[model samples]
Target chain A: MLDTYKKYFRFLVKYRGMFVLFVLMLTVLGVINAINPYFYKLFVEALPEKNYQTILNILILYVGVNLLETGIDVIVYLLGDAVILRAARDVRERVFKKIQDLDFAYHMTNSSGSLISVLKRGDLAYFGMFHELNGLYRILVHLILMLVMFGAINGQIAWLMGASFVISAIASKYLLAYNLTTRKAFNKQEDNVSAVIVDNLINYETVKYFGKEVKEQRRLSKAFVLWIKTLWGFANSFRLIDIVIGLISAAGLWVVLHRTFTLYMSDVIQFSDFILILGFVTSF
Target chain B: MLDTYKKYFRFLVKYRGMFVLFVLMLTVLGVINAINPYFYKLFVEALPEKNYQTILNILILYVGVNLLETGIDVIVYLLGDAVILRAARDVRERVFKKIQDLDFAYHMTNSSGSLISVLKRGDLAYFGMFHELNGLYRILVHLILMLVMFGAINGQIAWLMGASFVISAIASKYLLAYNLTTRKAFNKQEDNVSAVIVDNLINYETVKYFGKEVKEQRRLSKAFVLWIKTLWGFANSFRLIDIVIGLISAAGLWVVLHRTFTLYMSDVIQFSDFILILGFVTSF
Candidate 1:
């Protein structure tokens, strides 16, 4: 996976301009989204006073901002798509070239399916890394922005939310480690099922001529059942993790709400501020 | 494409029980999502009354529903993954078997790259068809549900939004058509680049022994330029289409907002209903 990602990174860097543009667009979009909660707060604050003109203006501005963001996002995606596809073509070509130049001993040992699988899975894993990097970056940026905003409004609540976030991160890491093991087991079972299906299909004519349809079907069915059993176990484990995570997030929300309400009752925070926090926590 | 889809359909039906379960899960998930707007409306309505207990209950219920939905979604994805991957494996095996069995004449006529492309792209196109079918079905289901919900709320607003949906659909279709053309051109240029790269890499030692590094680099650079020019053109065209579609969708939203406001002013709808419409309209 690391090697695959390194290769993909090198390829991406070869087209650095497009990637830079993509990152810039994402940054701009994130900034726009981060500011959006404030507009909503402003709109809600003006609503009770029957400020129709202010409401209309806010709505129009919100729509315009959303449109601008979407437009930029679309352009960025198009550019990204072109870059990725072109990169894949180049990589595939390189692999094919490498295979051709490889020694006869290498060809004798490596199955075509293995090579194809490597290329396919490697490309997917590389793409996964790219997406994960971007997602982690975005989350970190948003978290920092939220922290600064919350600290400015109410430090105690921000600190509480921040602590919960740290706990959530640690919990998520543990869950991921556990889940990865189950996922590997599930993947192996799936590979077995695929092996059976492939063997049957490659000799499909022979199976039909030999009147072994039932035999083949039974074999596939057995493999599939095993796959399902393994998957089902994984699913159950995943569900348990999900439930725990959900509860933790809910608990965090409850804490934040309690703090906000208590502060509001004590006249330390306004209702608008409370709504803004709610929006930020939920949206982010 | 049709033949590929038919073959995949047969494969899927051969595993009917799993397919049925997957579809049922998707439908249930869709229904849950369709009903969620109503829940949001209820939550908003309760907000003004400062019903803390109700809000807490709603929040818990929301988290529970989301967790349940996610669990179900994961299972469905696993099921689908098992089927599709197994099917792909079978197809790959069959293609390999064919390669083994094919006459020398056929092999001589086709380059290894072309054959590889056929095997890879054929299976991909098969998967693409399945994806397109699933998308079409989901869109249809969601559209029907939205129309029903919208009609129940306000027929005039529903009709206007429906019209906008039609416009969006037409625009999407046009964009897709244009994309297909550009994609073909881009693919052809990419293939050319690939051929050159493969040729150079496969003869790397020969080139090095003969000190042709500069010559090979120049050749590769020429291919790279061709690919870049084609890609740049493709991206520009795609960007133009995306911008147009984005603008149209924004305009559609404007129309929906106008209709919703008019209905609200006439007391034909409430603020909550308008919010729900906004959610549904802009979700795509």
Candidate 2:
């Protein structure tokens, strides 16, 4: 993995400034998000004081902060697009140039259909990797920050939240692994379906001469049957992941909120604290 | 659009039972979601009564309701996949067969690369259309249900939410139209990029005979340049939509919450009502 990243790093190094700025913006966004629940705590706590203008001021500031977050998000996306797309373009061009540099014998040995599929899938995979990595980074930052916030208020609740996170992360890991396996199978079938169609199209002359149009059509139909089956398998894996994650989140929310509500009832914490914790968990 | 859906309705009619069940589940889900904020109201309102048992019961029921929602979501996804994928398979097979039935002269006139692109994109477009339409349906259901709940509490707030929805919808219509235009341009450039590569691959022998590998490489390089430009244009359009929609949502949220909070301060509404409305808007 390190070796693979090292290779990708070369492409990104050219856009180092923009990439750095993008990461900075993402980190800023994550921090802003982690701190957001505190604002609700502030708002709710202010209400009991019955100072309308002060409350309104807090509300305005809160909205302003949210607006700022949106602005940062826009900037992050623009920077990400500028950096990732350019680097990907460079990588693609390099790959294209290298392919052309291959000897005649290599070209004769390989089917161009599969080659095109590999290249297309590779380009998309690059973008996917970058996008998912950024998502993971943001989630990590938010989770850690939230855990710290939770710990500051109540250690037991923090531990509960932490345990749930660990469990959910582990569950996601295994579930996503399973999902990836199904996805690979689906992708292979999809490629096969396209390859069949493309080959038929490319070999139109051969099919016409042999009068094998019906044969090719039957072949594509068979491919579609498998395609449909694998597609469902892939889709079903997503449902499985959602069900598992949803269950975990619900269980976590129930436990944490129950504890927080009990604390509030007993005067162990204020109502705003309860609301803050609720905001944090639900937003998660 | 009605005629287009009429054609799709034929495919869906085969799984009419599942389709009905899916729609019913969606409605139930939407109703459950709209009422969810009221649970927070109940929880908060019950606090002063010092009714631990009652509160716990409400909490349990709340979690149970959420679990039920998750269950329905899973069923909806499964049913949707079963129905849509199967129907789409039939449509794809019919299109494939129809393409084969086209005369030899038609086949001779059209390039296979573009035809293959059409078939592939069309299959995806069918899936996309179904997926997006279902999403729009869910949003519509959820919005209307939410508005009804809001109206029951305060007509002015309902009007506020309704107006925000209208404005957002109109903005989305225009913004998405812009997005679609950019997307089409991107798709055209993407197809051009791939067509160049596929054509070169398919005519490898011709290129090899002419020793035009360098020229082919340069052609692909030029195509990537345009592809990058159009892809950025497409990506930027999404940012534009997010900024506009985010601004509208924040403004609407600020106004509604400000009104609700002022009412709570003046004792025109209970603390629970404020919390409930806050839950509704934030959840949106």
Please give the RMSD to the true structure for each candidate, in Å.
5.7, 2.6
Chain A: TM-score in each model: 0.84, 0.91
Fraction of native contacts under 8 Å reproduced by each candidate: 0.12, 0.66
Clashes of each: 0, 0
Model 2, residue A261: C-alpha shift (Å): 3.2
Residues A1-284, candidate 1: write the lDDT tens digits.
46755877787887889988888877776677576557536644654554557757766876798799777777667767756766765665566555545665674564433344355444555557666877776787788788888898899989988998999899988887888788778767655654554444345457656766666666766766667677766766776676677667767877886777668656798766866776576566
The residue ranges of model 1 lying beyond 4 angstroms of the native Cα positions read A1-22, A34-39, A78-128, A147-157, A171-284, B1-5, B94-104, B124-142, B189-226, B229-238, B282-284
Candidate 2 Cα lDDT to native:
0.82
Best prediction by lDDT:
2
- lDDT by residue (B61-107, candidate 2, tens digit) is 87888888889889888888988998888887788778767778998
User: Which one wins on TM-score?
Assistant: 2
Model 1 whole-model lDDT (C-alpha atoms): 0.67
What stretches of model 2 exceed 4 Å from their correct place? Answer: A1-10, A101-111, B1-10, B104-110, B208-210
| Interface RMSD per candidate | 6.3, 2.3
Docking class of 2: medium
